[model samples]
Target: MSAWIRMIADEDADDTLQEVLNLARTPHGTVDNVMRVHSLRPSTMKGHVILYRAALHDDANTIPMWLQETISAYVSILNDCDYSLANHWKNAAHLIGDEDRAARIGRALHDRDPAAVFEGAELALMRYAEKLTVNPGQMEESDVTALREAGLDDGQILEANQIVGYFNYVNRLLNGLGVSTAGDVVGYYAKAEG
Candidate 1:
């Protein structure tokens, strides 16, 4: 599909976005198509890239990368945002590389209890993110309490919420704008048969 969004370089964004694009380009290759479409609106894209970097490489009491990926994939499943789900599951595999954990995550995607400890708690964060993503108006104190019970401090919970909410925005923009993937990432993931 033709991407419905175009990168418009008015003045400074051309430089800034180029730099960010360079950073995204690595052995992993170019940023995903979702990022490409979103970067057409440079300001939003840069901010998101910045926040995502922080969320993954947190400066505070960081959530474990494995746990974060678990949450990310679960949230992607709930949102049905294909790129997020695809990338994050691979990320989880890379970080943990445990077949049992991946299986638990697969089960959790369907709202089944994860066979791993803390897996269900991670899913709770994801499901809560789904609620906040699609229905911010209904967010209540109880949701925060549930997250707290799952062991998120207020800051961590807020950060996760922000990440979830931000990705929801990205998901909407990317999907509606007809973004695909960086190259053949989806196909590669499918072919991995993991």
Candidate 2:
């Protein structure tokens, strides 16, 4: 929980808030502090879950779950958001299931050297994520061009863009609210949800 604001615990939640909380709850029956912080407004909590599902969990999304998590981890890294970086990196690592590859991914993100771990479209999208997180204002059409040249279609590029944007938004939200990852089970997600 954030030290700056009050969060409604699961036991204290009203029916409506409880319902929204369920959408974001882990399989282990705990809600991350990031989602719990929205307890005051159940709608926003629902909105967060919906947006998260669409951005990172929707079946319609073409980006693989592991790569999506990678993009999220990378964005979190650039934002210096420990909560998201730790959680998302764990997600990426869990999905990858290769400790050495996951370590390489982590190191490359930390070093801001996507080329070290990714090639072709993956590399291009990672570079785009880094740029968007660090210098969004400096982005130009040429960045899109580079992604296309690297073999990413417009749809995949948009998927990457949405992921990057979503993480940036949530990173600021978590940081702004002083949310902590103390009780969260990193990398956990409901099998049926995102």
Candidate 3:
């Protein structure tokens, strides 16, 4: 799968683009197609890297890292963005460290059956993400009330909201740009925090 627009390869990047590309690179020294798509505008590329790290990898997020990745994967599934789905699911699985559990969760999310893998407040959060992804205009204040009722504090709810929102934004960006995982390092860019 190739991008609809031309992507500057690492070898062909100007000095500034090369620096920005470095920020987006995985441990394997390869860049994901999603980030590579921003190569034409290095500022966007830099902004993407910063936004991505803050959204999901920041130390301040209260939710577990694995669950955050799960939220990202769930959003990807809801949006039908295979590029995001594949990348995020792999990150979730790696963060989980249990192949069977991660696979089951992946199956349930892919099936759009959140109840199969999540319960209680987690399930409520998943439901919120689904609604926000599929029916943003219909979202009511009761949605936040439900998360609060399910034991999520405002900060936690905000984190979930941002994760969902971020994925929705990137999913559209990747899909609209025709970005695919081909020639990209899967899950290598994931910043795992303890």
Candidate 4:
């Protein structure tokens, strides 16, 4: 819940906000608390969803979905946003399908040691994400050069950058608004339907 305004869920959303609520629904059917916070401005919420889908879900993206989730979780960790961290960690764990591997990734991100969990292109990407999150101004052409050397073309590198930037923006938004992670997003939808 945010300290600024009351959380607006489906039940409480008015006509104008309902569209945003619908667009914000997760696969399980409930709207995310992050989206509820954005419900303060329906149009912004709509545009946010569109941008999110395009940045993270566009079919043409060469970056693997699991890698995108990993980038998001890593950025969330750097931003110290437990809300986004928990949600993205769940997505990453599910996509990765190995608890042990996921735990290693978590530990690596928490310890700020990407080498412990990744290598080759993955390691390069993680390092780039850390740099982008911690020192965006210091980012140089050399960083992009390294990713290219790791086999990512310009488009993939751009998508990776966008994903990192998106999560940073979202983590700050949720953290600034005092948003809490709603446990089991799917469970929220189930409970609401029941």
Candidate 5:
């Protein structure tokens, strides 16, 4: 599906926008549809890329990258975001080193019961992601307490919140804008399988 807004083509991009596009390219040598959709507002796209990298990739955070991807995948599933779900589930499977296990986790998360696939702190974190995604207004201190009890300190909980919030925002943005998954993103998962 085409986006509601026009994406700036590479050849037509201005110098600043070209730099942003260059930075937005995935390792597979293509920019994501999410980034391209944001080309209408280059600065927002730049800020989004920066925030996404920091939230998910900053080495200072103790949260494992695989877990982050799992949280993102869970959130996307809960939100019914096909684009993000496919992208993150692929990443999660790659990180966990077993596509079957990741697929099982995805199925469990889709059923709103990841207990079948996770345990202890991981389960706690998944529950937190669910509450934060489904009913942010109902969140209580007890929610934070659950994470703490599961061995996540304040910093790690904060990181988890940021990741969940970011994915929710992006999912809504893409879904609201009718942003279809890019061809390369589909190819990303296909390449992973082979």
Candidate 6:
């Protein structure tokens, strides 16, 4: 089992909760329903909210948000976490500026690749993230070299690994804890699809 966020009213939340949820609202129009559903999990929610923001907003990574989202979505898919799979796939579609790549990655992660992924960092990120998620210990220098050849740097490799690793950890936690996504956030994202 894992720890899960509990729902709360605005006044009861700590400063970090208020700030993080408020910030999420500004961009996404409201704190994500997944986040809201787990509001009382102050520490977990705070850490997750911050991690997601970093995943998308990091300045050091040469990769674009879409590419990062692709990595997120792909790993989420492998881990079978419904939590971020769909939302991140669509988000990646928006970030990457190409519907096809997003759709392709989504499908590829689901083992339903229509043909082959075209454009962007599909092959490299997928191979690397998959290797990391499926077998972190098994990763070799060749894997790192392949990712570098595909345009990732040392930091990017680390970031990708960390992102994939943490999400998997969180996904398992959520599953074991019986945590569910916040409906409002899901609906918001569903509607935001434009």
Clashes of 2: 0
Q: Which candidate has the highest lDDT of all?
A: 3
Candidate 6 on 3-102: residue-level lDDT in tens?
Answer: 3544665677688778766755625465655556557666666777777657656786666666677777777787887776757776677766667765
Candidate 6 displacement at residue 9 in angstroms: 3.5
List ranges where model 6 is wrong by over 4 Å.
Answer: 1-5, 11-20, 23-26, 98-101, 112-115, 118-121, 187-194
Query: Cα lDDT for residue 87, model 1?
Result: 73
Worst 10 residues of 3 by lDDT: 185-194
User: Candidate 5 on 71-190: residue-level lDDT in tens?
Assistant: 999999989898888788888888888878877887898899999988989999999999999999999999999999999999999999999999999999889998887554552445
User: Per-residue lDDT tens digits of candidate 3, residues 72-162?
Assistant: 9999989999998888888889989999999899899989998998898989989999999999999999999999999999999989998
Question: For model 3, what is the alpha-carbon lDDT of residue 37?
Answer: 96
Q: What digit string (tens of lDDT, one per residue) describes model 4 on residues 1-194? A: 44356776677879989977888888777677777788778898888888888888899998988888889889999999888787777778788879999889889889999899799899999999999999999999999999999988999999999999889889888888888755336322134444
The per-residue C-alpha lDDT of model 5 at residue 73 equals 90
Which has the higher TM-score value, candidate number 3 or candidate number 6? 3
Model 2 lDDT-worst window of ten: 185-194
TM-score of each: 0.74, 0.92, 0.92, 0.91, 0.92, 0.75
Worst 10 residues of 1 by lDDT: 185-194
Provide the RMSD of all predictions against the true structure, rounded to 1 decimal.
Answer: 4.8, 2.9, 3.3, 2.5, 2.3, 4.1
Q: Is candidate 3 or candidate 4 better by lDDT?
A: 3
Model 2 clashing residue pairs (backbone): none
Each model's C-alpha lDDT? 0.65, 0.87, 0.89, 0.83, 0.87, 0.67
lDDT by residue for model 1 (1-194), tens: 23766643324346777776665543345455655555666666667667666765576736677767766776667667777777777777667678886776677565734433444467567658768866889999999998888877888787787667666766676667766664535522243222
What's model 6's overall lDDT? 0.67
TM-score, prediction 3 = 0.92
Error of 2 at 182 (Å): 1.5
Q: List the residue pairs that clash in candidate 1.
A: none
